[model samples]
Every structure is written in structure tokens, then in C-alpha cells.
Target: MRLTMLRGPLLVAPIALLTLIPLLVVLGSFLHPQPEVWAHLSEYVLPEVINNTLILMLGVGCGVLLLGVPLAWFTAVCEFPGRRFFSWALMLPLAMPAYVLAFVQVGLLDFTGPVQTLIRDIGGDSSWFPRIRSIGGVVLVLSLAFYPYVYLLARNAFLTQGKRALEAAQMLGLSRAQGFWQVALPMARPWLIGGLTLALMETLADFGTVAIFNFDTFTTAIYKSWFSLFNLPAASQLASLLVIFVLVLVGMEHWARGARHYHSRIVAAERIQLKRWHQIAVIALCSAVLLIAFVIPVIQLLVWAKSILQEDLDSRYLGFTLRSMMISILAASLVSLLALLLVFIARRFNSRATRWMVRLATLGYAVPGSVLAVGVFLPIAWLDNLLIPIAQSMGFATFQVLKGSVAVMLLALAARFMAVAFQPMDSTMQRISRNQEDAARSLGLNQRQLLWRLHLPMLRGGMLTALLMCFVDVMKEMPITLMTRPFGWDTLAVRVFEMTSEGMWANAALPSLMIVLTGLIPVVLLVIQSENKQD
Candidate 1:
């Protein structure tokens, strides 16, 4: 018993500490002020980055609410032409990364692209269309990519309470719109805010889409500071500022949701009846959202990919594909195992410390990839410096030890995505019965035996789910992989970034399509799972 107790803290402490060091390192940058770099940043970069980031967040927040809430409400409660299909299909856009959509829209809609070119060819003016490289374009793409977060949560909230609220409102002589505004919408406030919080966090953490548009944000500033200016301290300082934004958002979410049991009865409400024109209007709205978000981007990607398939189908792509799959698999396997271990420890120990450990370990998902990349690399680079002198004394001529290696990339990825793997496993762990655990203990099963015989088998589904989620995320991840990957270790995302950066839209399409297809696996599985649960 004493040995088992010792094991929990011994195992958990190191993992939690490892998870925390990078964040601490980034936060500590303020102590070591880089005056020269800070002067240049304050003069040339900070103003625009701050202004653009704030505007981007505000725009994305409104855009998602506008797009997500109505779609969620209609699909949840109203009987429209395609309500059933739209409920799940609206989530299809989650598979399309914002950067992928950004480049696709830019490629097709830019001044010299086909859309404006055709307009010009037909003796029409081309300057009137909105530029696809502006702040508005970034907001639109990110909103389409992230609104599904709000939709998923808001729909669930409405499904549970929307119809009941409407019926109660009607009894009180309120109209349907009034019921939605005064009753149902307010009741779903927690879900709406929760979903909005997630969307905004993604917006704040975004690096790729903003980069593609050349729209300046803290994430892009961090990238340029490190890679362009070769100043790690400035990058760390910028990342710390970004971390402040994330922390504030997270704090607001917590305070807003404090002790609120908004979820009432889990009753399935009856679908609301709509007039003919209202039904038609709702159908058209939903169809337009789905069409723009998922259908058009997919078709555009297919068109570009088909054009490049003949020329781009070479050994070079095989290397890119294989490298991407290999690293994704390795990171997924590693993070899933660690996440499972943390879940097991939390369940087995059930202490305040263990809970805090779990929280710290899982906090990585809120930290952006660019921030994590800078935070993680600095410490590893410092350690490399420490070891290089020791190695030289030992007659070894080593310039770099751990810097620029796959291990650093894996570590950053594990930190950035720990929550992704932990959440599902923790939920599954919660469902496990205490009585079963006690009974097994009563039957003289040791801790190891208990885990090996019972817990592992039961957690297989969750483990696989975690693996798939992590795999897809790592495959789609850009900032960390781009910053941390060793030379000559380009993945599909890096390939897309390279091609898109150079304005080679056709070259980027194949990899973007691959990533979208990979991302769809989890979304499709989620839809199937939701259907099963509903059934």
C-alpha cells in the first residue's frame, strides 16, 4: 500500500513538472529583457499585431455566433426540409482547416485568380470583390472552420430544452421569436458561451490562416521574431503575451460557468412546426452555410488536386506522406499512453495533488502551438548548450545534442495536445463503477493486476479514440511541426505551407486534401457515435 501511494506521486510529479516547464520558461522571459529586440518590436510590430489580433477575435466571435446559433437552434428544434441531414452535415466543415480554406479562397477569388479573371474576361470590372487576403477574409474562413464548435454544443443544449421552453413561452402568450430570444437562448447561455470560448481560443491561437493571409497577430509575430529575427527571447516574450490572452479567456469561461447546472431534464423535445415560407427560409439558410463551408472548399480542393495528381504523384510526395503518417503515429501512440497513465493515476490515487497534476498536464491544449514550440525549444536548446561543453571535455565534438531533433518535436506536440487525449479517457474513466474497483480489490487483486485485467480492456475504446484524435491533430498541426521539425523532415502540412507561401495553389491542394480527408475520419466517427446515442 505504501509502495503504491509512493508510485502515484513519483510518476505524476515528473509528468506534471515536464508539462509545466515550457510554460514557465515562456513566462519567465520578462525577467531577462532583450532591450534591442523589445525596442524594435514595440516600435515596428506590437501596435499592428495587437490591433489586428483584437479585431480578428471580435470579428470571429460575432461571426461564429451568427453562423452557429441559428443553425444549431433550427436543426435542434424546427422541422425544416433538411434538418436531420444538416444536424450532422453542418459539422463537416470541422474537417477543413482554416488555412486550407484560406488558401483555396485566395487561389480562386484573388484578383488574378479565375473568379476575377473571368469577370475581367467578360468585360466586367474586377476591383469590386473583397480581397481574399484581408482581415475580413481571415475572419470568414476561421468562422466557417470553427463555428461547428458552437453548433455542436449549442445544438445539444437546444435539443434538451428548446421545445419545452417554446411550449412554456407560448402558454405565457409569447411569440416563437420572443421565446427563442427571451427563454431558450438565455437558457442555453452556458453552452453558447462555452462554444464561443472555444472558437475564440482557436482564433487567438491561429497561426496558419493568419500567416497565409499575411495578417499580423501575436502568433505570426512570435514566428517572425524567432525565425526571421533570430531572437528567441523576443519570441518567448511575445508568446507570454499570447498566453495572457489565453489565460484571460479561460478565466472568463470558468467564471461565466461557475456552479451553474444549466442542464435540466434530458427530454427529447418535439420538433417545432414552421410556416411554408419559414421552412423554406430555414432550409435555404442551412444549405448556404453547408455549401459555402464544406461543399465549395471541397470541390475547389478536388479541382486543384486533380490538376496536380499527375505531376505531383512522385517519390517526393511518398516521402512527405510517409513522414507525416509516421510522426503522427509516433506522437499519437506516445501521448495516448501518457494520457492513459495520467488518467489511471488520477483515478487510483484520487488526491488533490493528483487532480492538480492532471489539470496542469492537460492545460496544454489552451496554449497555442507556436507558443508551445517557442516555450519547448528554448529549454531544450539551453540543455543542449549545457551538455555540449560536457561532451567537448569528454573528447566528443558535438555541436548540438537535443536541439533540432524529433524528440523535441514530439515533446512539444505531446504538451500541446495532452488535453485532447486526456478528456475522452477521463470521461471514460469516470463512467467506471467504484463498486467494481472495490470488489476487485476485495478479491485480492493488486493495483497492477487490477489495471491490466480490468481497466485496460475497458479503456480500449477511449484509448483508440484518443489515438485517432491526436493522430489527426498532429497531422493537421502546422506551427509546432514547422518550427520544430528537423531539416529535410517536411510533412504534408509543411508542404502545403511551402506551396501556399509561394502562391502555388495547385501544389498545395494535394496535401490539403489529404489532411482534410484524415480530419474527416474523427468527425465522421463523431457523427456516427452521436447517431448511435440518439437511437
Candidate 2:
């Protein structure tokens, strides 16, 4: 308690710049929404937006549960020949953005696509296959990419519970099916729901995927209203609705998890062996998911690239992409540093209020990126108005650079990605023993010295994980950047969205490819680390 109280400034100082501003934006939005926008929302726009959002949420919720649990089961309990490889391979889809997958799916299944061509060759009408540019395709793409969230959580939960209880159920009158349904599934429910919530959030926050498909979801609606129609108030109103939906879903998850009463036993359970048929079934299931979600779409993207083989890329767009990357890198670093502070403070205090602070910080994760954009922008712009004048009076003329510059881009990225930074730090802090801090204190180390000498060393890997995730997150970001970016600023995601919207697939495809490629790096590192630890 002493250490925690004394260390507040060190833990809280870095985040004060971030935490104070975003809330000001959200508050301003609520208090000052235009009357005309409120009328539009109350009459028709809000209902359609809310319905479409819920529909997408329901679709992803069901799809992820179907894929995530079974795939996790295959790896955790039942073994297939390539189960080892597939266990990690399934995570590859996670590296692909929904918008990228949207383009790939459309190219492969639209009227002029290869599949339709092959069908026409077989004396079949291409109309036999539904167009991929619809709600169904959006759901399909989102579920495939997002199910890995469920798989990761569910698989770990299963391994943690182990098989001891599973065997005892077998020794009783219960069959394997009964035991799994009644025993194992309940134990994994918390993890499954947690994964489901993540998938739902991704689906809800998605803009590129739904927009490319011509869907009317909240994310797309906001992009259209704000950027295309120049209706800022309308967009804010829509974004607020999206935020409410997300809060409800998150609340339900919290309620359900809090309601759960099961306890996981500490002793390791004997691992279950898969029957021959079960092994084959497992392999087939994983293969089918990968084919639809990853393999087919990737093949289609490559095929499309073949036609653009000789085209010279525009120098301007290339520069745009490079500019985006640099900003993303810097913003990722800043977000991670501030998040490190928040996580350390939360863990150090480890009290009800501190825990709530940590949760509120992560609340940015559930709010649509567009909502977070609103939350971050208003106060920051106001702050700049104050700071720039003071600096100019002090004979510093260029301090005006922050008003609508790359610095704003970096701060927006930090507000959006604070959650990503908090997650790994939270997990790592949980594993730290209190005795280490006690031992350091007994050795006459001050709080700062103990943190630097003891806690920070043990947390390097987790901090790196947080930093890398933030880097990739900002790299693929679109919604918040679209809303908050300074004039003339462009990101790879923005470039991809722009090109795809204009039917310039050839250029869009490259940047989409770049986005996925960048997202893959941190994921690859994390996977290798996971594999190494398992070894």
C-alpha cells in the first residue's frame, strides 16, 4: 500500500496527457450535438444502424462459436495428424484485416470471378452462386479472421483445466459426448464468451469490410456520413448509437462471467487421445475453415496481382503509404509507453478503484474507432489552440505544427490503441509475485529503483508484445484515422479504402497486401514465442 501510494506520479504522469483529453471530446459530443442531426437519428437512421449492427454481431457470434470451440477442442483434447501445425496455422487468419478479406472474397465470387468463369465453362449460370458483396460475405469473412480470438482463449482455458475431471466423468456412467457437453464446455464458457466478445467488437468496429461490400452497418454509415457526405453531426450521432450497442454487449459479458461459479482444479488432467475417425474429422474441419477464410481468398488476391504484373505504381500513393507507416510506428511507441504506465499503476494499487481505472482505459477498445476518434479530437484540438499561441508569444513560431499534423495522427493512434497496450501488461503483471517487490524493498531499494531494477526487467517481453501489437494495429487502422487525421495525411488503410472504393483494385490490392504483411510480423513473433515456451 505504501509503495503503491508513493508511486502514483511515476505511474500516472505519462498517461495524463492522453487520459484527460479523450473524455473531453466525448463529453462535448453529447452536450453539443446539432439539433438537425438529432432529428435525423431519432426518425430513421438510428434504428437501421442499430438493426444492422446487431445483425452483424449475431452472425459473428454464432460463426465464431461454431469454429472457435471445435478447433480449440481439436488441439486441446483430440489430436489429428497435422493438429500440431493447424493449431498455430489457424491463427494466420487473424493477421488478415476484414477489408482485405472482403476484397479477396468479392474478387473470387463476384460475377466475373474465377469461380463463376469455371461454372460458365461447365454450362452452368454464374447466378447459381450468390454475390459475395452482401451482409453474408461480411459475416463470413469476419468470423474466419476473428474466430482465432475464441480459439486462443478457449484452447488455453481447456489446457488449464486439463483432463483429470474428464477421466472421472468417463469412469462414471457418462459418455465422452455427455462429459464434454456437461463438464468441459461449462469450464471453458468464460474463455469462449471472452473470445466471442472480442470477435463481436472487431466485427462492430469494422469499416472497410462492410463498406466495400456495400453494407449499411454503423461503421460504414459513419464513414459515409463523416467523410463522403461531410455530415459530422450525423456521423457522431450514429457513432454514439454504435457505442451504446457495444457497451450493452460488454455489460452482458461482464454480467455472465460474474455470474459463473465454476472452479478450475490445479492438478493436471491426463490428456485425451483422439480416435482415428475423430482425428480425420478434426483435420477436415480445420482445412475447410482455412480454405474459405484464408487459402481461397489469398489465392484469389495473387491471381488478381498477376494481371497487374507490368503496371507502374503511382509515386504519390507509394509516398502516402510510406508516410502512414512512419506515423503508425511512432504512435505505436507512444501508446505502448503510456499503456505501460496505466498497467503498472493498476497492478501496483490492485484495489477496486484502480482496477476500475484499468477497465475504463480499456473501454476505448469496445467503443467504435470512430467514437474513440471523437473522444480524442475535440480536447486535443482545443489544447493545441491554447498551446500554439503561448509558444508563438514565446518566439516559437513552428509550434503550430501540431494543429492538424502528423503529431495529431500519432495521438489519435495512441487513444485508439491504449487497450492493446494494456492487455499484455495486465497479463504479465498477474504473474508477478508480491515477494519480489518485498525482497527489493528489504534490500533498501526505493520504489523507482525497485521498479526499474526488478519489475521492468521481468516485463520486457510483455512490453514488447504490447508495443508490437500497437504497431500493427495502427498500421491497419482506418476509422479513427479517417475521422481524426489532419488534411493531406494518408494511411495504408485509407489508401486501400480509397482505391477499393473507386474500383481501383490493382492499386488497392497492393496496399491491402502490405497491411496484412505488416500485421503478420508481430503475430509471427508472438507465435514463435508461444511455441518456444511450450517446448
Q: Write one digit per residue (lDDT tens) for candidate 2, span 34-107.
A: 88888877686767777777788899899999999988877776645887788788888878888888877777
Per-candidate clashes, comma-separated: 0, 2
Question: Which tens-of-lDDT digit does each residue in 70-138 have in candidate 1?
Answer: 999888888878777988999999899899988988888899888899999897798877888788889
Which regions of candidate 2 are displaced past 4 Å? 1-24, 31-35, 259-271, 380-403, 532-535
> What's each prediction's TM-score?
0.96, 0.90
Leading candidate by TM-score: 1
Question: Which candidate gets the maximum lDDT versus the true structure?
Answer: 1
lDDT (C-alpha) at residue 174 in model 2: 86
Determine the backbone clash count of candidate 2. 2
For candidate 2, the 10 contiguous residues with the lowest summed lDDT are 8-17
RMSD of each: 2.0, 3.3
